[model samples]
Target: MNSIGNIKPFLQKVIRSGVGRWRFFAATLGLLVALVIILLSLQLYLNFNQLLHGKANESETAEFLVISKEVTAENQSKKNESYFLPEEIALLGKQPFADRVGEISSTNFIVTISSFSNAFPFYTDAYFESVPDEFIDIKTEDWSWKQGQVNIPVIIPSFFLELYNTGMAMSQENLPRLSLEALQAIPLRVNIKHSGGTAEFVAHVAGTTDRLNSVLVPEAFMQYANKAYGYQESKPPTRLVLKTLDAADPALQSFLVANSYTTNSDKTKLNKARIIVNWIAGVVGIIGLIMLLFGMLVFTLFIQLTIAASRMDIVLLQTLGASPRQLSGYLMGMFMPVYGAMVMIALLVLSVLQYGIHQLLLQKQLLVSPWLSVYTLAAAALWLLLIWFVNKRTITNYLKAG
Candidate 1:
């Protein structure tokens, strides 16, 4: 070990004397550029994912979309054509983009809501819709109901309040604007009219949701009321609430268009942006991989050139009792540090860019980590290992041949 240690510096000096400075510098620069580009592509992908799927960016309403058949002139008069058949719902559920599919049940009976307080007097004919409890964004204890319940809980769309405040309240002299808290405090008189008679139930706003744009009621209450007061037989669902993994998936948009289904455009507007980003990232990654191959090839040529130039010196050293393993180890020790340094420099540059991007995106209300992603770090380590393997193999083979 001591003899080998003593010979390392001499072997390193002999090996490096034959290396062309210009070629080594160019090879190092190319390798650094390749690593940076590869890491940059990976970081871009992760940052986009963070913006879309991070906990800080996640919305309870983002995963749910209320979809319905498009009301075209041809299908408007045909009630059956507007409804989703059981097979259609099953097929939608089986789709890769849809995590789960739920039917949006609507009341079959006449319904009306009026303010109980004369001071805030307003009356309107309304309809009630219900979806499964899991799909509802608003969670409240009052959302459940049983038979003979005197009071019914209701959930309204947040935009409904906005529309009333901006449109109706501005137009009417007697109507006053209501805040969400005030709206929840007001009690409503719900009148369920059937062919037999009208039944009254006191209803109160339990919550408001940005997800579903409908007057929502407990599914249990909707089922019971539709049975007890329904003038017509229950029909298939005309609307569906879908739970999806990605609201902006392009395949989801394609499927909707193919089946004449329509959903909220605002929720899916990012589909094009996502596709564009993916294409850009893919192109960058491919370019980086090509450059990396060229870089590795150049590095291998540099090594081969140095070994060929030092062939006479290496033969003399081996004849003077130095082992091929010792020379190979010394050559590796010289080159591996440079490779490690290049990787570190690439990571540092990426971290700075990521932090800058994180701050920039924060201004636009997008959230991403300032540090590098685990996948990026893993990729760096993997590439470093590959470089080491390639360098080691080249040194061992050249030393044996010499």
Candidate 2:
């Protein structure tokens, strides 16, 4: 440390006399800009990945899609075409995009739900649908049923409550607006009518879901009721619920269109937007890489120029017993601090930008971390090492030639 400290000033004077200060500064500025662009592009790519695939951005039910046959004019009158055949279900399950496919089972018996209280007097014929318990978003202990259980739990669509509150209650003189809590508190009489007779069960809203647009019941209850009350043979499902990692995959959309199937458009609407953003990110990253290569080349050329101009001085110093290793070490020590400072400045700028982006995305209900991703940090370190290697090689090669 003492030797390095004593020799540093003399080496600085010799190198400074040889290299133009303005040229060195220009090369450094270019390197800094290139580094910043590379880091920014990496950070942006990571941010988009978090928004698209991060756990914080995933809803419990977002990966599930309820698919059904498209109701076209030609197929509207054909009852058989409306239901998916056994071969069709098997083929759909074999699709690469579908992790698993479960049929949406409809009630085989007629169902009627009526308000139990006189204050909210209402009676309407209703349909019940059931899917596997894992697919249901509402997690509750009450979402279970067995034989002889008088109380039944049901999950309704969130829009049903919203429509009643906004449209129905506003127009009706006596009907009061019901919140989710209030709706869950009220009991309704569920009547199962079949060829045998009528059976009544007390039912209450266990929860509401925004994922599925239908009234839901426990799979156990639906299977039992369908077996006991259904007068005809069981029919194939008209709809299917599919589990997938990416609902916005274009291949999934193309398959659906080719097969004349349809699903909730809201779930797959991000397809185009995601594709466009990915393309833009890719292009930006390529541009940054090109800039980084150019910056590295400029730094190499600058080091070569400095060594060439100071060849006589370097040879005299060697004759005076300054080792080649010492000279190389001094050159490295001189430039490494500046390179480190550039990296720090780039990271600082990215951190601030990332924090601002996180806040902005949070307002729109999208999730992203305020900190830089590990991949981005690793990339920065890798680039720094690459620059070091290039600079070291250039310095050693030029000094040997001198």
Candidate 3:
């Protein structure tokens, strides 16, 4: 302790004089440059990854369907075709179905339609006129189907008018008529008798015989039309849609499938890929941090070597009663300003870059992800530990070499 106290003034003089400045300056500059390059590269990589994820989400949403069924698993294999639900179910819960499921339906209808000419106003006009003066009662409409709705809208074929060659022009609103052109045809309409004593509406129209003449109406309205036209009342669909649950979470998914189900997102591969990319990013980050630490180590080592090589100067200080610990403190203190500045600058630049990225990707619904935070903090800690280890080792090496 007395030796260290005696060494303090001599060690302080050496540092305060700022000897061998150029080499250390060059090494520090090199570290800063490397940090800039690494940060830029990582930012670019994550941006590209985010764009890819967005496109994948869009594509997957477009191509799947859903089915909800109540039958047991044994029934799925039964050869009875009557119990088999339609293979393609449209959007589940909105129109064709409602917005409930996410599939397309395969059922199609064909029919011929004739307008009432002067005998009938246009179909659109006819329907519009039926509404009350101040208030209107109409079903919400959509071009596609989902599930969970009581009624669904249908799109009529565009070729219907051309095929009939019904030269007579009629109300654009009510130009076409519907009917069965052949026997065994699914009724064009179904009659819906509300449980009320007398109220009823015509709903869904099944397939017709002719393709060009088909008309589309709400499922409920078609039923009412069948009854008004003396056809049998539309019966409830005998079959329900079914689909298999994937094995990943078979119990819960299977139960949901039994009730109302659609295609499940297969996220195993996606999750695996995410882990891999993050790991790679982490590795890259670690490498950059390692390089930074190595540069710092090299700088410390270079300073220590320069001091050791100037043995005559160290001996002169020793003659002046300098102690080892004070020499160590003196050497470390020489770089204090540089270390502090480097840390502050690195943190400041990173904060600005991250803030800019956040602003740019905000509207894209992009996020850094929670895991990114965890990985980043872990990386920083690892780098700090590496730096500390390297710093200590450099000091020890200098003392031994001396």
lDDT of 3 by residue, 228-308 (tens): 432334333333222222112234344345544433335323444555666676777677767776787677666666576
Collision count for each candidate, in order: 0, 0, 59
TM-score of each: 0.89, 0.77, 0.41
Flag regions of model 2 displaced more than 4 Å.
Answer: 1-19, 48-64, 72-102, 114-123, 174-189, 193-202, 231-236, 242-261, 265-267, 311-324, 352-374, 396-402
Alpha-carbon RMSD to native, per candidate:
2.8, 4.5, 13.2
TM-score between model 2 and native = 0.77
Among these predicted structures, which one has the highest lDDT?
1
**Cα deviation of 367 in candidate 2 (Å)?**
6.9
Query: How much lDDT does each candidate structure score?
Result: 0.88, 0.84, 0.43
Ranking by lDDT: 1, 2, 3
Looking at model 2, the pairs that clash are: none
Worst 10 residues of 3 by lDDT: 128-137
